[model samples]
Target: MKKSFKLFLFTLLFAYQFSAGQNQKKIDHQTLTWIRYYNVLPLTEKWALHSEFDNRSFVNPIHENLFVIRIQGRYRTSKIIELGGGFAYFNVNTQNPDADPDYSIPEYRTQQDITFINDIAKITFHNRFQLEERFIQKADKNGLLDEFSFAYRFRYRLQSTFTLWEKEQNSLKGTISDEILFNYGKDNKRNTFDQNRIYAALRYHFTPNLGLELGYLKNFQRRASGVDFYDRDIIRFTVYHRINRKF
Candidate 1:
């Protein structure tokens, strides 16, 4: 009877191992199909600085050309907390001959983020909160309109990374993240303006600190000053590099 019991226990263990292995194989296949890279540089160390420029154009003939410059800085306060701030400048130039001349807008923001890392899989969960103010200069608007207007914005983003294959000189990473935004204050037109953005990307890294990212972005914005809602589909290509960090 004791010999029979041992045989049964061995069979059960073998079956459990086989099932777990199959599940892991399925997960690997699904997650590794596409690799993703992030434009927001990873904070692997105590301090980081990053900057990039983006240009966008629309199919509409009456619209304007859009160019954006972004600068970001981050500092780690602790194992789980981080503080950072950045500013962005936007330039919009009209294409139509009947339209007004070029105009520029500047936006400044400060933010804090917290992260929790899991040791086993090395997965990290990041939470971010921020505040921003924007200034717009237009030739048509009067005196007070030229002044900077204050608007408060709140955002939440969740992202994760998984290592597919790591060799001596090359690696692939897959990233998935989503963000939601809310705007408040006087310039937000009585707290009615809001925006929602979502992105999915794939990245290939030739080195640990340098890589390229290609992604799709969906943006929805409601302007309090306008009657229509603006929806945009954006294809983004970004280059990422981290300097002065050890991971």
Candidate 2:
């Protein structure tokens, strides 16, 4: 399964590169900071609730970029497989940080995912595949809200983590992850390859239930025009918390 999944991802990536062609792509470069919080609450041995809050901001002039909230229910079917479904809300600003007044665009998304976990030689790998239904509020030339546009997105992420140092329950670890996204539906006109994200982080665990991560992420995205792209560098700080209980 892992080999097949890797082959599929490589094929998709090849297609994206081939489609890019020789056209001189216009790129917009920007720097941003992201703050995030993640929580996991166990309802039972096999059921859990996961929640996330994220805030993003532009760096140079200090402007808000995006805000997001997500909630999901996860069920562990076995030691190595989990299934999850979730809802997410997003408030986004213009991708151009230099816009006179940053307008807010709202989006609602519902998604489902399956995750496979593997442990080999003390390194743990997670492979996650997800599908999303997105409803984005459109805007007119004057930035007035219009009817919503619907789209479907598919995402695949591969992540790996290994212990860097360990003493009792407190430890430090390094993580690397990559996610690729593709878009489909009537609303997606020019591009099927939406974006790709690459991230690396150092995480510190204070206890079994709490941890902190500092990471850097690079996002490369193709716009609706297909000729325009965004290259974003982001600094991210995250807090992870877990609560275990039964009701």
Please give the TM-score that candidate 2 achieves against the real structure.
0.91
Q: Give stretches of model 1 more than 4 Å off.
A: 1-45, 59-64, 94-101, 106-122, 138-145, 190-193, 244-247
lDDT (Cα) of model 1: 0.55
**Relative to the unseen true structure, what is the C-alpha lDDT of residue 160 in candidate 1, on a scale of 0 to 100?**
52
lDDT of 2 by residue, 213-243 (tens): 9999988888888778888999999999998
Clashing pairs in 2: none
Leading candidate by TM-score: 2
Per-prediction TM-score to the true structure, in the order listed: 0.67, 0.91
Estimate every model's Cα lDDT from 0 to 1.
0.55, 0.87
Which ranges of candidate 2 are over 4 A from the true structure?
Answer: 1-23, 100-102
Rate residue 242 of model 2 by lDDT.
91
